[model samples]
Target chain A: MLFTIAWRNIWRNKRRTLIVLSSVVVGVVALIMNDSLSIGMIRQMFENQLGSHVAHMQIHKRGFNDNKVIQSVVPDQKRVEEALRSTPEVKYFSRRVVTFGLVSSAINSSGAAIIGVEPDREPNITIIKKSIIEGRYLSGASHEVVIGKKMADKLSVGIGDKIVGMASTVSGAVGSDMFRVVGIFRTVSSEFDKSYVFISLGNAQEMLELGKDVSEFAIILRDRGLVEMVKSKIAARLGANYEVLSYADLMPLILAQMQMYKESMFIVYIIIGLALIFGIINATLMSVFERMQEFGVLMAIGMKNSRLFYMIMLEALVIGVLGTVVGMVVGLAMYLPLSAYGIDLSMFSESLTSFGVGSTIYPVLTLQSIVGILIVIPVFAVLGALYPALKAIRLEPVSAIRYV
Target chain B: MNIIEIKDVEKTYHDNGVPVHALRGVTMTVERGEFLVIAGPSGSGKTTLLNVLGALDTPTKGKVYLEGEDLSTKSRNEIASIRLHKLGFVFQAYNLIPVLSALENIEFTMMLRGIPEKERHERAMALMEELDIAELADKRPNEMSGGQQQRVAVARAMVNDPSIILADEPTANLDTKTGANLLDLMQRMNEEKNLTFVFSSHDPQVI
Candidate 1:
């Protein structure tokens, strides 16, 4: 009976009820848009890292990651290559002999991380081949190199210029090589661009005197979701000499960034919840004060105070539910088409790349987030109505009836 | 058996900074199945006395007993329960919940009592017919006349089969003929069901 009464009573002042409902709808829409944008940006950042530099998984010597020394080269390169070939999920893999060296041009010299990669297989695993701005990809072991555009600018060297790379060999001898810059590439991350220079694997091994040994195998997968499964399979096939690690293990900073985003989202939820509570309280309080005499008469005629409180709360609940359903419908209406087409931030691509995000992003709406909105709205509505309902019950029947 | 007992009940109200006495140590008793009228002019404490008798207001001093139980010793919730099950009221303004239809207004008390819907509807319809307001059952208070809304209010009070009905100026907004007819209906119900009715009115015409 109170349900029926409350449902009808809320419509007594249609303008007031609509005001409260509008605030709720607006709040929910803002929450949905904010959530979608955050999720989209985070997903883009992870994808850029995985597609450009960090493939789904990597294989290296046991202590290679902690200390990048030439002595920690993989012991059995042939057996690891065979395991990777047998794994169906491994789309492409490249052998790499990486070392920190100084690359000096005629006019400038700077420290750089030199990655000696198999030129033919490296193109299938990383985006560096597509990101080349000027000149062609390296074809053979003719001392041809591909350096980042930022590194090229720092060296004041263009395509076809010869740069000398000096590094220490595994045998404790200083080895120096001169390579022609065949390609200059620009990546999404400026940090990555300023630091890496790649060369042919055979030439790198000959110069560094590490014959037939590479430091790591960067493996790209057909499905990113199957990364763990494929990593386990490769680990089982190879012996304890090889270490297989997923992208998450290889880059802990990205995971930490994701965790920080999640914490900030929780704070946003609390702030939105507080705003909704105030909206509901103000509207319900006005209604309560207007019905002061009516409540007095209700109590005088044997209506229980608890029942009156329940009726007021029921009114708030009805408004909360009605507003939430409408907000979700409207929000999804705006979200579905945009999710299909995606939001393009290409105009600000430079700024986005600095943050390590792709130019285009697709907004994702998860079931957990949708359920969170549903649970939060009505709970806040009840909280907002509590003080006003208490005041209604405390009304003195005799004095309230006489109130002018 | 005495249905109500008041022993030297006194009530005071604060007006701005001054205390005004509304009830000055008054005492009264009424037997069961009796109809009583409390008559006084404005500011003469008739409404205050009725409010104390109905347990709507507590006295500053002394005690009020309903059915041999001291109401002053009871908690607020206990008083509310007593009012729900044992007492009914009709206010001067014909205080029908504006949103509810006439039949729903009459059914309100029975609904609070947790009566089955079927039983509540039947009792409400029977009472509406007896009061000759059966056709107004579906009409809201705003759609009905003053006399019809009061009929619905009176029917609501009696639907729970309360032990006593306290009416504060029940005919204050009605015409002379309508007030007389309403009084006649109450007298017939009182005689037929042996129910108690107490009304407070300042009008000599109603008396």
Candidate 2:
């Protein structure tokens, strides 16, 4: 009966309840949209990094990560490859010999981190070949280099032009090789484009005097979700000779960047939650005091103050659930199509690239985010009702009956 | 047996630092099955005296005992339980929960006591029939006339079969004929049920 009374009481002043409901609905819709967009952008950052550079997992020699010298190459490449091939989770793996060297053209010179890869295997590991703009990707064990566009521009070199690459070999001797630029690629990050240059693994091994020894293995999985199981299986098969690391371990900096975004977004949610608290508190308090005399009569006849308090809370629950449902409907109406087509942020491409995200983003609403909002609305409603419910319970029946 | 006892009760109000004494030293008592009228002009403390006797307010300097229990010794919740089971109150305005129908308003006190729906429903209907407001059972307070709402208030007060019923200006909102009719109804219930009735009114017609 009290529940029925509470439900009907909310509609007693239609304007007041509507105003509160609209505020809650609008607030929830805005919050859901904000959450979806943030999730989309964060997802893009992870995909871009994993797809372009960091594969799902990497295998290296125990101390190879601390120091990237030619002597730190994987002690036994054939063993690692055989184990990886046996693992069903690993769809693709690439062998690479990495080093830093100075490449000089006739007109200019700049320092570059050089990666030596098998042309066929490299394509399966990264999307760099697809990003090539100027020329063809490296084909075989020729003295051919695929440099970034920024690096080619800095060195004033183009495809079919010769550039001298100089580095120290495993024997502690300086080695120099002449290479023709075969491709120039541009990734989302201009800084990466300016510093990374790639050559065939055989050419790199010969120039650096490393015999069939590769720096690391980059593995791509059939499903990215299988990364952990694959990493663990590979680690168990290879033992302590090699260190296995997931993408998160391989890129601590990116993980920190994601954490920073989540922290700032948490602050935004807090601000929105506080606003909801105040709006609900104001509306419920008004209703409670407006019916002060009626409540007085109820108390005088023997309704406990606690019962009255709960009735007020029941009203808040109705408002919270109603507003949240309406807000979710409106939010889904706006986000579903937006997720399918994606929002173009090309106008802010420069800023986005600095943060290592793509220009166009597809908003994704996760189940966790939906459940989070559903939980938050009622909590806020309860918090908002506390003050008014306390005030209602504090009403002296005698004075309340006298209240005009 | 004494149903209510007020001993040298005093009530004072502070209105912005100015003390206004609503009740001076007053003593009163009423036995069970008594029908009494507390007559006074405006500001004469008739309502104040009734409020203190009903345990709605504590006496400033004295004690009020209802059914041989000192109200001052009880906690708020205990007092509320006593009021729920021992006393019924009817106010000047009908004060029915505007959202409830007449039958619901009459059944509200029993519901608070956790009475079963079927039993309370029968009791409320019988009382509504006795009050001649059975046809208005489904009407909300705002949809009913003043006299009809007052009758619902009376039914609500008497629904619990309390030891005592307190009516403060129950007919102030009704016309003379309606007011007399309400008094006669109360008087008949008082005699038939052997229930104690107490009222405060300045109207000569009610007196």
Best by DockQ: 2
Candidate 1 residue lDDT tens string, A1-404: 88889998999999999999988888777778778877878877777777677788999988788889987898898899899888888898999998988999999998988889898998888889998999988897589989988899999999999999988899988888999999999877666777889899998898899998999999999898899899889988886877899998887888888789778888898898799899999999999988888888888877778888999999999998888888889888988887899888899877777787756767877776788888888788888899999988888877667656
The local lDDT score (0 to 100) that residue A127 gets in candidate 2 is 80
Model 2, which residues run further than 4 Å from truth? Answer: A102-111, A132-136, A141-144, A147-168, A171-190, A259-266
The 0-to-1 C-alpha lDDT of every candidate, in the order given, reads 0.87, 0.89
Query: Could you give candidate 2's per-residue lDDT for residues A188-226 as a string of tens digits?
Result: 666677888899999999989988889999999998877
Docking class of 2: medium
Per-residue lDDT tens digits for candidate 1, residues B67-86, read 99999999878888899898
- Candidate 2 DockQ vs. native: 0.77
- Scoring each candidate complex against the real one, what DockQ results? 0.75, 0.77
- C-alpha positional error of residue A403 in candidate 2 after TM-score superposition, expressed in Å: 2.2
Q: Cα deviation in Å at residue A344, candidate 1? A: 3.0
